[model samples]
Target: MVHFLPDILAFFFIAALIAQRLSVDLRLPDAAYQLITYILLITIGLKGGQAIANNASMALIGHSGLIITMGIVITLVALIIIQIFSKLNKADRVTLAAHYGSVSVGTFAVAVNYLEVSQIPYELTLNLFVALLELPAIILGLYLLSDKTHKLNVKTILAHKSLALIIIGMLIGALYGEISEPLVKNLKPMFGVMLALYLVHMGALAGAKISDIGSNKVFIVSFALIMPLIGASIALFCSWLIGLSHGGATLLAVLGASASYIAVPAVFEQAYPEANIAQALFASLAISFSVNVIWGIELYTQAALLISSL
Candidate 1:
């Protein structure tokens, strides 16, 4: 798996570049993006739900809640630093905060594959954390950006497709458990294939957005690299404190380092129309996504090893 990692990443990245070259005439990347997101989300949700159903225990539920809380804390700490250091407008800062705070499904999925190939076992409930970490950062970022008089619309959030799919998958998992495994047998086997296809679209998206990030290139670039490191640092301490195994700690670090381009962007479109979504999108998809996928996992694993030894 480690040997093939470079090839897999290169294939998608090169494909994305090719797609970008041909994008003037075709909407192939967009079509792929829309189609694969639903597939990935549903598949991820179902897998997590099944794990939860099988392991149903108060401890698991409690751990899940703590994971969500960690996400909120990460968001707050990130926003605070961005607010102090960045010269971007309030809206952009909040947008960046939301993006950094949210989880990246692509990076998370890749980390899972890496773990599987490395023969390291991770908690199945880690699947649920992908979805669990999506919302708090978005809501908190927007809330902080808003004036005291502003009230967020709960209905709008609940209606989001990303959140809805997660809930739907969990409901199915909790009620049906593994009974529906046979039904999804075909789809289950295709998760890796589906992910590779997804990365192609991601690469294309990143290539397209990379050039449009405006004048604050230094700031954006620094934040893209630094924010993930900060998230990884926090998660390292928290995971060890919570007694997560090495694999679990590595995953938490990967997720901590990942920046969301999907769910958070959708949330921002409706919630913070004033914010510059393009910059946030570029930072997450173009820079941070690549950073995490390429070297971020290795960084996390190494960081965990270092921390455990200390």
Candidate 2:
């Protein structure tokens, strides 16, 4: 019974949801939420950059390509699932698939915390994979869309605030490895605190979307619940095939399971305005995000452990 309750950062998320359900009038300011986002993105970037600096290798290039392929495959599969099971229009299907295909940094942060709590060691370069996984889904979504009017803007995607911060942080970390040590040390302690704050904000937002599950209740809810399991299973198999460590496999599975609520929404709103962005966000943030935070993380970790031992 105790194990079923939310613990650690998840407690903040679940508490926020409960508060929202009770109409507690608790919410983080928009500016503060954005600030937290910036901090998290930069922190992940810096840490990953430092790791790459310490362990640069040609193998990373191969691994990166493989990860990108995984993102593409996930997006395609998600689209296929949506097309078959969902009555959403073509644009909405592609857009929603894009949301599932991309990685969620918030979820990644939680998984990282989970690994730390369990004393599991993962490749620091996993953040690099986080950055790598963001683009392919969006790009594929754009390409698949029937709308040919909006050209794929590589520069715009790269310059998106989230990716820019991460890339810049990585560059700084990679260039000034020793010099950035003090900054990383100072920020490391605040990582968990910031993530908890973010999740609190996220939970409130997700709670508000509870009524927005809309007409496709069965399909949306079913997909939201089941997609993470499918995605995590595929990722665990990939991790095993590549011989990733237990922590590495777990983190990868989390990334695979996560659905993007931030980056994908921002891009899709502008690029494909006709798509039902609100419903997509509701599905990804409210249902999928909640599922991952509450139960999926533990399941993925255990599954990773099993795969690593095989």
Candidate 3:
């Protein structure tokens, strides 16, 4: 039973969903969600930084470039698909593409927990990849907006709290390596509990949005179900080309498959006020997130193992 505890934690998401259906008001305060988000971001950043400090080399730099390129490719493909297939307006197509293109820290956290419980050894440096994968999709999304007259505020996007916290944590971890070990050690143990708590909130939020899918329900549902598999396949191929371990490949697949519910939504809400933020969130958070949490993680791991064997 203990071996499956991490998997068991995922059930809280379902429980929260059920509670929401029953009109049980079990929502966490906004502040609590923010706090959990910060801790997870910083912890991931610190660990990745420590890994870099230990394994700093030109190869790592090269790999970082590849990861960034992967993110850009994912974003472009998402945009193209939305353009060709969906009947969503220009602004919404770009917006949804951005959400799909960006990575989700929450989903990444769940993948990390899954790897740990399975005793799968992935590169700790993948944490750095998480930070790397966050922005390119968003920048492209903003640029592709129909209103080109709207100046792109690069400075504001850079200063967004989520990205800033992760970067800050990474720098501290890399620079302070040994000195930061105690802090990392202390925070690491709390990861699982914190993640489970956060998922409950996510479940409730997703549950509330279940009936609020707005228009294009068929298209949105189809895209959410299918995009992750496509993303994961591409990522797995890249992982094999780059010589990643099974665990590393699995996590990379997760990163590729995740959609940015938090960062992308927040940025688009402010920057592209005309975009339908709730619709995008419903697809990313409600549908994509649920698919990844329930089945995608295990499936990706299996695919990674197969690739590694070949």
Query: What's the TM-score of every candidate structure?
Result: 0.90, 0.96, 0.96
- Minimum summed lDDT over a 10-residue window in model 1 is located at 21-30
> Residue 264 lDDT in model 2?
91
Clashes of each: 0, 0, 0
lDDT of each residue in 1-310, candidate 2, tens digit only: 9776865798899899889989974569989999999999998899889878887888887788888999998888898999998899998899989999998999999999888988899988788889888999988998887345878877656667887888899899989987888997898899899999999999999988887877888998898888888788878887887789999999999999999998999988887788888888888999999999988899899999999999
TM-score of 3: 0.96
Candidate 3's residue-wise lDDT over 1-310, tens digit each? Answer: 6555436667888789889989985668999999998999999999888878988999999988988888889888888888888899988898998898899999999999989987999998889999999998888888777355677889757868889999999999999987888998898899899999999999999988888788889989988888888888888888987799999999999999999998898898888888888888989988999889977888899999998888
lDDT (Cα) of model 1 = 0.79
RMSD of each: 2.7, 1.4, 1.9
The pairs that clash in candidate 3 are none
For residues 220-260, what per-residue lDDT tens digits would candidate 1 score against the true structure? 88889889999988888877766777788898888888888
Error of 1 at 193 (Å): 1.7
